[model samples]
Structure formats: structure tokens, C-alpha cells
Target: MKKKDKFIIIDGNSLAYRAFFALPDSIMTISGIITNSVYGFTNMLLKIINDNKPTMLAVAFDSKKPTFRHKIFKDYKSDREKMPEDLASQFNLIYRVLDVFNIPKYQVEGYEADDLLGTLATQAKDKGIEVLIVTGDKDALQLVSENVKVIFTVKGISDVNIYGPEEVIDKYGIGPNYIADYFGLIGDKIDNIPGISGIGKKSAAKLINEFGFLEQILDRVDEIPAEKIKEKLKQDSEMAILSKNLATIDCNSPIRIDIEKCKLKKFDEKKVYELFEYLEFRKLWEKIKKMNLMEKSLKDENKFQSRTKLIVEEGELINLIEKIKNLKEISIQFLGSNNDCTGIAISIKPDVSFYIHIDSKEKEDRFFNLLKPILINKNIKKIMHNAKYQLKILFKKGIRLQGLIFDSYIASYLLNPHFREHKLSEIIQKYFGYIAFFNIYSNRAITIYCC
Candidate 1:
């Protein structure tokens, strides 16, 4: 039998709030636009995609308009603090990033993100698609069932706890169906839901496990062994019911699931790379590049093949130098260490590159001796990534590298001083719009592209 397709629904507001608090606000773009929330959210998104490999994905965002729960209680989430300006400023950027990924995002005026998640999850589950709900809110646990699981953000944005039916039972001492009942007994301070005066988690779990739900517990309140507990349940019965209603997620939200639209497909890698570059997400780009998530454009794909020639003979090396003798600039990359240099690749033009293998001491000495004039020429400009390392290696070989004009590593750092590390693959993808492959073996040499 074929495996069922996985559909993931994300609570965007809850995740953004959690990420905003988990990461430091010091993470901002060069223009002073705060990006901690977006950074964390995107990080979590990439990780989820890499790990789960979901076929269908969508994000549900909470609308600015008040939901039905607010109208019912008139004080729903009244105690919650206002959203921070820094986090609020990044919501548009987050939306743009989601668009670049082609992930469908929905926001209904009269429902919270939880309601949309519940509705979509139920719809997908009924259609035989495996559903995963990603959120930081515990209120989403009530939606857990056999076919649906909740990926609850436990701490920060990375640490998470997945909850199935049995996991929910283990955590709450009752099944997922009774999560709202438990919440009703013990009020949710985060949402300002008022439960019974003294009921807590232990009492709520016992009451839920004993009875069926909030109504059943209230109906059987008279049979309680403790007088005070029974009195609280009976006296505050209306409040308990209201709290449960508030905690319950509405599965019939005003929305429909478009499976085809939610299905993951190839996205515009160039647009995503440009956005990351503008946002100065150097490290995130590197992570995505390492994961091989970005697809190369047609132009790049054609430019990346069979253009590297290996020169093992003296005649070939002499011809290669003659071809590059008058070139204004060239790109160079050295493989291996100074003492045990394996090979060197040189690009005299956009379409052509040559790798000279260094097997024996004689070959290494001869190759450098033939190329030393160009290497030490002050007029022919040389470009590299991490020029300092290459300069050190060349100096150790008794050949001084001259006319060093451009270093992509330094350029990346200068572009974003906040970045901790600058990688050549990331820089190439960010600016050149594609990754250049560089592979070297113990006995064989492959051409490396430095453009």
C-alpha cells in the first residue's frame, strides 16, 4: 500500500508570538527592521519541512478583527498584553516569505487560527490524509485524534513535543477529548477564561477521568466526597460551562481546504534568495543551501556542467597559461592544506575552468613554477572567497599572490556585520542565484567555480 500524504497546519500567530519571545530582539536587518520573530518562524518552518517532508502545508493566521469567542464572553483574551511593535512590524515580511514558499495562508475575521487549524485538520483527516498541527498553544490539544497529531512548541522554537491520543492521555491523565473539560475546571490565565474558584489541574483531571465532560461532572457534583469541592462545582457550574465553551476549538470554521493548493511544489528560488539577501539572513540561507532545498535555475544548471577540464600534462598547462596570460581578471580556489596541497582550480572566464592535479612533489613544484608569473602579477586581478587563507597557503609555497581585488567572504561580512559566519556557498547562492559545486577526491581533481 502507498503511504498517506501528510498535511501540516500551522498556527501562525501563536508561533510568531512564541518565536518573538524566544529569540532576542537584537536580531534585526541592517536598516533597523526587527526580524527576530520572522527569523525564528522561518527557521522553524525550514526545520519542519526538512524533518517531516510534508506533502501539503498551510498556515492559519489570526485576524485583527475580534473572534466569536470575544463576543460571547466580552473579555476573551482581555488580560493578554498588546503585541510588541518590533514583532508587529515583521508580519508583512513573514507573509511575503510565506508567499515565496507558495504556502497557502488563511485568516478569517470571526475565527482564531486555532479554529482554522481544527477545521482544516478535520477535513484532511476525513479525506484520509495524515494531519499535523504545529502550534505553541495548549488549547490546540483538544483537536488531537487518531489521525491527527499536534507538534507543540515546548521551549523556544526548536524544542517541541508531539502529541497523539496516547501522548495527550499521558500528559493530561485524560484523553484529548477531555482537554477542554480539564481546561474549563482550571481556568486559562493566558486567555482570561474564568473557571471554578479553586479547581486546579489535579482536581480537573480527576473530575474529567471520573465523569465524561464538564456537564457530566456538574450533573454529578452532588456525589463528590469533599464538601467544598462539590460546592464549588455546583455553585460555579455556569462559569465552568462557559470556560469549556471558550476553550473548545470550533472545527466548522468558515473555510474550505484546497488540497491541491496546499500541496508542496517547486518554489521560486531566485525570489526566496533575493528576499533572504535583502533581510540579511546569511546563516539561514546557508542552512537552506546545505539542505539542497533551493533548485538551480535553467541558466545555472546549464552553466554548471562539464565545463571543468583537468590538465595533467605539461603541454596542457602551458596552453592554459597562454589562454589566460592577457586576461584582466581570473578566479582561483585552492584545495587541501598548504603542506599537502591536492589541486588548484582556475577560472579565466565564465564558461571555462581548469583544475591542475598535484600528485607528486615534482608535479606540484612544476605546476606552480609555470603559473607563478600570473600568480605574482600585479596587473591581472584575482578574485577568491576567503583570500586570506589562500594567501597564507600561497605564501607558504614561496609564491606571493598579488592583485587580490575581491573576497566574497569579506564582502558578505561587510554587507551584514551582524552575521557570525560567512560561507562561500551561501554568498554565491545569494548573489549569483545558484550554488557552484566543488568536489575533490584523494587521487582525482574536480573543477571548482569561484564565481
Candidate 2:
């Protein structure tokens, strides 16, 4: 048999809510934008993608409008508190993250995310595809079958329990199909579904296992062995039916499932990097770099070509200085430390760069003297990765590095203070999608200049 295509459906609202409460609210950006929910959600998403490697994936989000359950039952989810302002604010950011990952997201006006997940999972399962439904809601377990599994979040965002048909049976003492029935007999306080008054989990499972469904048990109430249980069933038969209706996930929700569109594909690296940088998700950005899910554009490749000129002759050095003298800004990378200056790389333009080797003290002195005017010019701005360190090296040589406008290392640190080490190679790879090759041990610097 051909290997089945794996389809992963996420309950966006449920997972986001879980994540919001899982992490502390102190996880904020430099601008005080709280990102606990987004960070946790993205972390969970990355883990799922890395673990399952699903062929197709999508996230189903709940809309602001009241769903069909609310229409049928006015008390549906009425007991739940209003969403926190901080968590609500992060939803759009999470959506942007999904877009960057090239993952399609769906939200229907009158349907909950659970219904949407059910619809997609059922459709995929019917087509002989393996379906994985990710949610914190236990109601999703009803969707589990031979080719369907429910990744139920048991604790916080990280810990989870996977429920196949067998696992569902093991847990509930009933198959996945009777989950709604079980909930009908035992009310859900969270959703405010009024199940039978006297029935609990054990009694609910027993009834569901015996009579197959809520209707069957209600119809055969007189045959029940326990008189008190039968009376409770009779008294709350209508409520039990309503509760089952409320608890049951609608597998035929009015949404189309385009399997081809849901296929996991390469995402635009630049856009993803921009969003990550904006959100200040340094660890996640680093994680994405390791995943290598980005497609390098031909433009990036064409714009970056190594055309390095080794300036050995004095005439060559003078020509380079004259060429870049009038430029408003330039990028410089220093190789080696202050004591042992090895070489210096300068770039006047994006594609044009030059490197001058400093093997002896005489050569270092001569190079600094020739380039001192341009380097010390306050009008001509300079950009470097670690400006402070480079400034120290330049200061020791009596060349005060002026017009230091941007320091990428400091910027990266501000973006993510939790980062242990903000290396230039990692920064280049994160933003430019280019693997910078240099000898760290030898203190060699590879400079790619861009305005």
C-alpha cells in the first residue's frame, strides 16, 4: 500500500488560550508588547512540524461572532471569563506568524475551531489520509479513528497525550464515537453544558458502553439496573440530548478542504525573518534557521557575489581610498584583536569590497594613516557588527572610528536579551539568509556590505 499523506489540523483558539496561561505574562518585547501566547504557540507549532513532518497542515481559528452552539443554548460558554487584553492582542501576531510559515488558516463566522478541525480531519480520514488533530479540548477525541489521532494537551503547552482509538478506549472505557454521549451524561462545567444531574464519569462511561449513545440510554431508561440512576436519566433526558448536541463536534462544517493548498511548502525567508525580528523572537528565529524551511531567492544570491580585491600594493590602497572617499557610508570588518591586527575589509558598495592584509606593524601603521581621514570623518557613517569592540581596536591604533551609526550586535541583544551570545555569523544568517564562513579562532571577519 502507498504511504498515506499526513494532515495536521490545529485548534487555534484552544491552543492559544492554553499557551497564554501556560507562560508568564512577563514575556514581553522591548516595546512592551506581550508575546507569551505567540511565543508558546510558535514553539508548539515548530515542535509539531518537526515531530510529525505532516504533508499537509492548517490552523482553524474561532471567529468573534457567536457560534451555532450559542444560538441553540444561550448559556453556552457563558461561565467563561472574557479573554485577557494581552492574549487577545497577540492573536494577530500569531496569524502573521502562520502566514509567514505558509500555513493556511480558516475561521468561519458561525463555527468554532473545534468544528472546523473536525470537518478537516473527517474529510482527510475519509480520503485514506492520516489525520492529526491538535487541541487542548477533550471533545476532539470523538474525531479519533483508525487513521485519525488526537494530540490532546494535558498540562501546559509542552506536555500532551496522543489518543488513537485504542488510547481513547483505554482512557474513557469507551470508544471515540461515544465521547459526546459520555459528556452528555456528565456535564462540562467549562462549557456550561447541563448533562444528567446525578451522572458522573464512571456512570456516564457505563451507560455509554451499555446503550451505545445518549438516545439509546434515554429510550431504554426503564431497563437500567439502578433505580436512582434511571430516575435521573428520565428527569434529565431532554437536557442530556441538548448537552450531547452541544458537546458533539460538527464534522460537516461549511468549509472546503483543499488538500493541495494545505501542503507544507517552503516559505519566504526574508518575510519570516522580518516578522521574527519585529517580534524579537530570537530563539524561534534561530530555530527556524536550523530547520532550513526557507527558499533562497535568486535576487539574494545575485546581489551577493565575492569580488574581493587583496590590496598589497600602496597604489592599490590609494585607489580604494579615493574610490570610497566621497561615499556617505561604508562597512568595515576588522580581523584579529587590538594587539595583533591581521587584516581589514572595506566595502564601498553592495557588490564591491576590498581586503588589505596587515602582516607587520609597518603595514598596519601605514594602512591606518592612509585611511584615518575617511574613518575619522564624522559625516561618513560606518556600520559594523560589534562597533564597541571594533572601536576599541581602532582607538588603540589612534584612529578614532567616527560616525558609528549602527551596531548589529547591540541591536540583536536588545531584540532578545535572553540570548547568551550574539555572534555576527548567526546575525548574518538570520537576517541575510547567508552562511557567513570565517575563522572564529583566527579572529577573521567576513563582511557583506548593504545599505
Best by TM-score: 1
lDDT of 2 by residue, 213-237 (tens): 8899988888999999999988878
Q: TM-score, each model?
A: 0.88, 0.81
Which ranges of candidate 2 are over 4 A from the true structure? 298-302, 310-331, 337-343, 348-351, 356-387, 391-451
Residue 262 error, candidate 2, Å: 1.2
Q: Which tens-of-lDDT digit does each residue in 270-381 have in candidate 1? A: 8777888888787787687677666554246445557777777889999999988889999998877767667788888888888877778788888888999999998999
Give lDDT: candidate 2, residue 92.
97
Highest lDDT model number = 1
